[model samples]
Target: MLKGNREQELIELAQKMIQAKSYSGEEKQAAETIGEFCKANGFDDVIYDRYGNVIGIIKGNRPGPKVLFDGHIDTVPVSDESKWTQKPFAGEIVDGKLYGRGTSDMKGAVSAFTAAAKYFAEDTNRDFAGEILIAGVVHEECFEGIAAREISKNFKPDYVIIGEASQLNVKIGQRGRGEIVVETFGKPAHSANPEKGINAVYKMSKVINAIRDLVPTEHPVLGKGILELTDIKSAPYPGASVVPEYCRATYDRRLLVGETKESVIAPIRELLDKLMAEDSELKAKVSYAVGEEMCYTGNKIEGERFFPGWLYDQDEAWVQAVVKELNNAGFNPEITQYNFCTNGSHYAGEAGIKTLGIGPSRENLAHTVDEYIEIEQLTKVCECYYGVMKALLV
Candidate 1:
């Protein structure tokens, strides 16, 4: 059982972190705070990696598969401050809710795990396997699973728990996200004499419509793959007297199980080919690229044109362990999925590690002006974390 003051300490820390406003690429201050908490509490091997991920290791008395608990320290950028009922970073406990940025999306989970770290350190009633690794990772909002890949290079674990907003339930799997760009070329001509120029925008319009017409594949657990036009740009003038020659559009593709790069790209490529076949003048081209942007921490991340989706069986030991623990603790664990992306896809899809998600949040509250978490929920999450660790490690 967690102490009252312990739960309060976790809430206070999460609020402080939210106030720091550690956006996707700026998680340094919060990471430092978490590192200090772990060290002050006597957690061993507390360390921060090159990517700004704060980690602490608690060695078990015996030996078994290593269990890792991960949560991103970053939060999505806040919207208009006025839109929030309370100051977004106040961490105020108003009517039982801790209102703040990242409160629900994740800082709450970090806080819960931090509390769990303290609980495991002080608790003598339970004993178990290998070790418990608590990871306060950076940059989860943007690229979903980049942290898993960046951190996995150092600590390879047998089981991973993603602390996303799961309302303290166990999440077996979730859909993946991906991105790519489409470009089209045309001859530039004076608008006064349209015959002298080919309009790339005109050709692109057909392609965009075709893209909308193609539906993505769906799954029972992971749902459907979706393609959204995130951006569009035109090169050359579209002046009253000039015609545009080149155009490009970027796509945000969310992939589910059975949806691969070939499966994702084929339909779009087919559309372009069909247009070209129908009209020799319609010379539209399709291309794919990754988003390899840099952060303040200098971690260069490359996101796919589409984020691949994944699913873990509910009966799997990884899932069952957490579920059983939650049940034992009087929590009727709602076994579900993360509607949004998280580090799970990367761990389950790319790294192939068994992963599950349980956290103190509701996914919808994330990225909204009303972003907040129930203080009680944050506390409950700590208990859930401790319960899962106790069950799995033993």
Candidate 2:
């Protein structure tokens, strides 16, 4: 067991991480803090992957499966810090809550797991089996699991633990996500004589209405495959008096297990095909959005917006053992799943590795102003992660 103010040390590290201002593209300071903490602690090795993710390792006495604890360092931008009661980066504690950006969205879990890994090593003295790897990942705020491909490459893990907020519950799976773009084409003409050209907005309106009538798919546990219209745009803003020639609509598509890029949008594609065949004036297409961003290390990270949904059987031996261990440790955590997308989209969804998420604080607290993780939550999550290490690293 770790001696002398271990909880205080965990709080200090979490505060440092919050103060670092690690937005999506910039995580250097937070990464450095993690690296230093790992080195100062009992980690056997610390490595920075190509995408600038910091990976800290604890090797056991004997050969066994490698278990990875993953948490992203990047946080969504605080659009207005002045609106918050506590300073967004101050990491202030008021009435037992540690307030700051990323505290709940996930820097807190990063700190918790890091401390747990350190403490587990100190307690066991390398007497256990297998290895524990903790990673502070980059660019997760922008791309859920894109940067994690690098971590997967560097450390081929037998299982992954994503520390997204779960309020101390064990997450078995999550609904994946995809950004689908639909566009309509038309001819631009003077507003006074609308018949002279096709108005793209009008064409898009028909497509949008048609989409509303289309039924979404469903899953037994994950709920519905929702395709909600998030936003729409038209070309030539402030057109003064011209018919818009083009229109684009972006839909936030929540996915189910076994969903693919092609499968996710096939319905929309077919709808477009039918519309085009019926009305020559209606021309449109649907595809998954692609995005790219620069990492703090200057490496480019990019991927298709499709992240597959995944679920693991609750009765699996390792998963059951973990649940039993937590229960025996006096933590009656509910066996649940994340409603939102997580880095599991990569590990479990894409890479086919087993993945689960369990962390401190409520999922609703993420990205909200005056975000916080209770001190009780912070410390318990650390202990829980230590419990997880004891359960899985054998």
Error of 1 at 240 (Å): 6.6
lDDT of each: 0.81, 0.92
Write out the backbone clash pairs for model 2.
none
Give the range where candidate 2 is weakest over 10 consecutive residues by summed lDDT.
1-10
Clashing pairs in 1: 176-307, 176-309, 177-306, 177-307, 178-305, 178-306, 178-307, 179-305, 179-306
Worst 10 residues of 1 by lDDT: 120-129
Residue-wise lDDT of candidate 2 within 1-394, one digit each (tens)?
A: 2345998899999999999999988999999999999999878999987788999998999999899999999999999878999999998999999999999989999999999998888888888889999999999888888989889988999999999999889999999999999999999999999999999999999999999989999999999999999999998777679999999999999999998888888899999999999999998999889999988888889988988899998989888889988887889898888999999999999999988889999999999999999988999999899999999885
Error of 2 at 314 (Å): 1.0
Give model 1's TM-score versus the native structure: 0.93
Give candidate 1 misplaced runs (Cα > 4 Å).
237-241
lDDT of 1 by residue, 218-336 (tens): 78777668789999889764455678889898887778876778878888898899889998888877767665655657867666645567788888776777788788888988888
